[model samples]
Target chain A: MSCLGERLTALVDGELGHEERDRALAHLAGCARCRAEADELRQIKGRLRGLSRLPASDGADDLPTDDFLTRLRSLAEPAAPAAPDDASGTRPAHPGTLGGQSTRPMRQPVRGAGPGRPRDNRPAGRAVASAGSGALRRHQRRYLVVGAATLFLGLGAASYAAGGRQEAPAVTPAFDRFAVEHALTSGDTPMTDPLTDPVNQIQTSPGP
Target chain B: MTRYTGTGRARRRALVAGGLAGALAFAGTVTGDAGPARGVRSDPGAVGLLRAAADAARRVPYEGRRFLTTWNRGRSATAEVAVTHRPGEGVRYRASSGAEGYRPDSAADESAGIVAATLGLLARNYSVSRVADARACGRAAHVVEARRPGGGTAGRFWIDSETGLMLYRELIDATGRRVVATGFTEIDLDVPAAGPRITLRPAPPARGADRPDPDMVDAQAAALAPWGERLDGARLARLRSEGWPIPKDLPGRLTLYDARSDGATVHLSYSDGLAAVSVFVQRGSLDEARLPGWQKTVRRGRTVYRREALRRWAISSGNGYVSTVLTDVPQSTAEAVALDLPRGGVPFWTRLARGARRLGSAANPFG
Candidate 1:
């Protein structure tokens, strides 16, 4: 009946056995810092649940950085464990676990007597979380920008091709080329005499 | 005195009996002759005299100053003539006044040429059948009457019996009216060189003031030479080879034929068939505005806008086809014997008219 800080968090989430739950409740009653830590973790979890249910509005002006950080801390926290299976002789994993998709026993946040001690470790952890969120946001923005640019380019190309087809049909090249050839050849031997006799003779005569 | 009177009565009776017998013999001779007895057939000497006179008229070139008196519809018109002929060199001067003068003004030179050609034919074919003693211009002359072999119009000649010179000549029409009559008031043939001083007058100015177009006449003639014959199979084949489409039956009597070059293309035709019209294309434009009895009409083609003159023509241009009734003819029988021509075979008439117009404009030395 060891009542650790981790077991207390598990007991609150209904993951602990009856004996373990009783033991965690007794320890919580004696240690004030652990109780405070448990209370803060519950508040973060409630805020995260509220964020997940928040409706997307037309404007983003009201969303603050503090609210986003609160939601992130809740999602990043470890979840409660489940009970052991006696038939398989193996312990069941916890529910609502973090990154690895594994269901093992839950981990808890550190408890300290002074606020200064927790604050000292909070900056480093916050920096790492902020950096990860920033990377993800930047990747999402790049994907959105690329998609919009591709859509605009596709629309422009389609319009240009349609306009070309709607315009005048292209003429055959052979006809224009032959017309130029005939004009050039006939220029040298323009009919000068109004009389038809000489032109008729030339037309009728066989080539020499 | 009583005896003398009785003798005169007996003498008169004897003279009357003799004269009656002579008259009877002359009547017998006239009745024995055939075809216009005792007229043209009775005199061979007169025929010989006319033939000689006609020959002499054409051979001798002389300058004459005379007067012309014309009677039309019982009205008389007079004109003075001053004509000089220089055998081969052509007529140098001719001047006339009055209505007769105007008739010869535009066609003076052409008429002179026709007169010369007629005289030449007469000179070669003159024959006389009768001769008689007569008086002309108050001078004693030998009158001769001639009959042509084909029974054409007769010719009468009055020659100076003393000098063998012709004094008067008459060319009778088929209707017995004298179509042409020429007489010398004071004829002196083969006279001495110094007899009378003949004064030379200045020639009249040309009728048309415009310059003559010789180049147009030549060019038109060359262009029209191809169309001078009928559009038969051979000619049609030739024209087809030249890329011209000729209709099968172009109905018309060709009245005019002309081909000449005078700095332009000129052609004229008058026909009386389906489209009785005259077509004149000069320098590629229709130029027949002055053809007689023709009315102008518009005609369209692929690339040409033609204005033609339509008219009913009586004369045809071929060698065997009869002309229509639009022209004057002696009889329908004569017209039946006349020739029929194809649509394009009437160039001579046009050529003559064009030449006359061109020559009439200028006093060309060569012409």
Candidate 2:
């Protein structure tokens, strides 16, 4: 009832015998979990094959080289455990197992060396895939920040320009003081006239 | 008693002879010197009488009930107030309803000396003559008439013969219709031993700390800052140089006789001998909402606020200045003066710069 985990990779690579492949496909039809893993393996294999066809030294820096693709393909194949005399003492991590999440550990690019240079035991394809996705996310975040800042400054300038003239303070003229002041200057008694007196002002409509 | 009567008649005859001789001398001087244009027989001594009347307003001490009457559209409106004058102190006016107002002597000295000073303009514009001697308010008075050059009496004044105080005055239009009349209905030259009690309303508080003044609000609205002392000619000239609208003359032959200013407002008084108009110019636009129940009129593409009761008031605002013309003249005259003031808003660059400053202030973190 468990999945044919190793056989699924083998089935995707077409390395199994005809009878074995037919048996694996029959099991995959009954087990959705195994079928999904087989499909992911097939896609990864197809991408690696495509990457292998790219010319070496293509001038585009971001594109991984043919040597990196070869290393990635080697990392993708399932191999037996290394012997004790092997220098690395372990096999390179499998590319098929790479979950493609940004949080997953990836190989640091070798400094002062082209992507074709082999340095870490980690799979080159997984590292390039994770790094490329992270770079894309960073670019998207930068664009968002710049757009927001532009909008803020634009709105501020617009508000300032649209704000018309500054008017003097709102003032209600002192009719009584004006009356008294007028009288003082005009040689008349400082008295508020009946016209300016609010109490005497009838609430009348505008006269014709 | 008969001997006293004979002496009085002799004195009367001598006074008449002296008046005639003085008139002749004044007429000869005016004719020989700068005579008025073409048959404008100006009684040179009449100007002195009017000036004396203006001086008597400040020099004499008296109390009386004065009435002002203005006629408009065939109806007359009259307002009466009790007035008390002191020789050196000031004048106090009290309405029948118990509202009181006071003007200090310093204010009158610095400003009102203008009324008498502008009488030369009156003489130049009118053919002033001492028309007659009449009785007014139970006192003998000298009648002085300022006749228009075309032949109608423009103004008449009844000056008390003994005190030289103006007892009554009236202004008449070209149609010989009475425009405005003010006079003492009852006067007592014998001042009371104790001056009348004063209960003047308190002045408004300083700017930004002001509370509503109930008396002022009842009379008009929120009180404005009191104007400083009257501005002299030099100061007025300086203000004009600094772009203040201090015109020397207005329509209706009203010459600027007095000018005063606070920091924000400039008060200019103009008169044509018969009518006194006060124009108050302040830097700002009018808050029309504050003027409730006032009539809004537009003349010659300008908006004027008109209010007519016992006096006429017209207010207009433009070119960063709000001008209010207050007088007892007809409403049409008030409107004309209000409309005649400068119009148009502030320039575009000025407005833009002002707007920028306001924006900067709003954006300041500590503002």
Best candidate, DockQ-wise? Answer: 2
- What's the TM-score of each model vs. the native? 0.27, 0.56
Candidate 1 lDDT, B1-367, residue by residue in tens: 8888889878888888888887888777755332232232324455345445534443445455433232222333333344333333222222321111111122223223323333333333334444568898667888766555346545676786765557666545445654334455444344333323222222232112231221332211111011212233564455434322222222221222212112221122222110112222211112233223333232231111111111012222221111122211122211221222222322343334444445445446666
- Summarize candidate 2's per-residue lDDT along B160-274 as a digit string, tens digits: 9999999998888888999888889999999853454433333442232253433454542332223665688899877665546677877877888777776567889888766
State the lDDT at B203 in candidate 2: 47
Q: What are the per-residue Cα lDDT tens digits for candidate 2 across A127-196?
A: 4444567645654676789999998777556555644543556555656556655655665432434323
Error of 2 at A108 (Å): 72
Among all windows of ten consecutive residues in candidate 2 chain A, which has the lowest summed lDDT? A83-92
Mark the 10 consecutive residues where model 2 chain B has the least summed lDDT. B200-209
Query: Could you tell me how far off, in angstroms, the CA of residue A70 lies in candidate 2 after the best superposition?
Result: 71
Report, for every candidate in turn, its global Cα lDDT versus the true structure.
0.35, 0.66
Q: Positional deviation of B344 in candidate 2, in angstroms?
A: 6.3
TM-score of 1: 0.27
